[model samples]
Target: MSLLETLEMLSYLVTIVGLPLAILTFVWEQRKERRNEEEEIFQRLSDEYREFLKLVLDNADLHLLRREGAQTELTDEQKERRLAIFGILISLFERAYLLVYEDEMDKQTRRMWQSWEDYMREWVRRADFRDALPGLLEGEDEEFTHYISQLMNEEQKVP
Candidate 1:
């Protein structure tokens, strides 16, 4: 073939192969970046939950970790503190629900969300937490309120 014809054929080959390859690579990288961002968000939320647990541990006198709740009646000041802690926990759960939960999630997203769901289930299992939930959920995200309410109901049904 003439030099110009050879050059034209090379351009055609590139158009047929390189263009689609480039598009595929771009899409793959974008997906990978999105996954990384999601992982980072999940990690940050996990850290916040750890901090909240530390707060719970610090107030062990309140017996917030107990499934049945405090053995003794809480003094007024302790009641106030316990309510405040419950409020903080509700806020964290709302944030997680807003950020992580979705109506239609991919496998990776669902896996990450399962952890938050388990946390909510654990808290809802606590009688004191269930009792405080209505007050703590006031003015929170509507979807989160609905979601946690469902969890509370489901947990209540279990023996």
Candidate 2:
């Protein structure tokens, strides 16, 4: 073929093949970046939750754990503290549940949250927690309440 004819064929081949491959690569890179951003957000959320729990454990309010099921009545102060602690916890976990419920979360993020599940179950099983939960959840989202109820039921059956 003449030089002009050969050049024309090469241009056509590049347009047909190279353009699509370049477009595919660009799309793949964008998806990967988006996935990385999502994973980072999940990691930060999980880390913040861990840190918050650590702070809670460091507080003296943990005496409530022992008093939770006791016949002794908690003072208004103690009950307020309990509500505050659990309120923080529920909000964090509810954020997680909503994210997962909507399928915006991936398994790796779910696995990261599994560490908190035991603590969550333990607290939800507390008598005071259950007693106060209905009132606390009254203003909350229905889906989150259902999710917490499901977690509670599932945990109760696990032992």
Candidate 3:
């Protein structure tokens, strides 16, 4: 074929093959970027959880309060302390529920939530926590409260 004709055929082949390849590469890159973003979010949430747990574990009173809660009528100061602790816990759970609801929680992220879920189950049973629940729920995100409610009921149903 003449040089012009050969050049035209090459351009046609590129349009047919190269365009699709380019499009696919672009899509693959986008998927990779999206995965990286999800991973970063998951890591940040996980790190925050770990650090908080470490802080509680490192403190004797905080650790006791978290594990057994109040065994008797608490003074106003104790009540306030319990409220603050639960406030932080519930807020973290709310953020996590939102992340999962927003489709940001991958398999690893969901797995990371297992401990939090277990804690929720146990926390809901605490007398101090039960006392605090009503006030805590009053201002929480509706969907997050609903999620916790389901967990609370599930824990209740178990023997």
Q: Using lDDT as the measure, which candidate wins?
A: 1
Cα RMSD, each candidate: 1.1, 3.2, 2.9
Candidate 3 lDDT, 1-159, residue by residue in tens: 999999999999999999999999999999899778767776777787777676556544534344466456666775666577677777877787776444355576567566567767777866566667778888889977887888777766776
User: Which window of 10 residues has the lowest lDDT sum in candidate 1?
Assistant: 126-135
Listed in order, each prediction's TM-score against the native is: 0.95, 0.75, 0.79
Expressed as tens digits, the lDDT of each residue in 1-159 for candidate 1 is 999999999999999999999999999999999999999999999999999999999999999888788999999999999999999999999999988998999999999999999999999999888888899988998889999999999999999
User: In candidate 3, residue 139 scores what lDDT?
Assistant: 83
Which structure among the candidates has the greatest TM-score? 1
lDDT of each: 0.94, 0.72, 0.72
Candidate 2, residue 104: Cα displacement in angstroms equals: 9.1
Clashes of 3: 0
Which of the two, 2 or 3, has more TM-score?
3
Predicted candidate 2 versus true structure: per-residue lDDT over 25-79, tens digit per residue? 9999998997787677667777877777676667555464463554656678777
- Candidate 1's TM-score reads 0.95
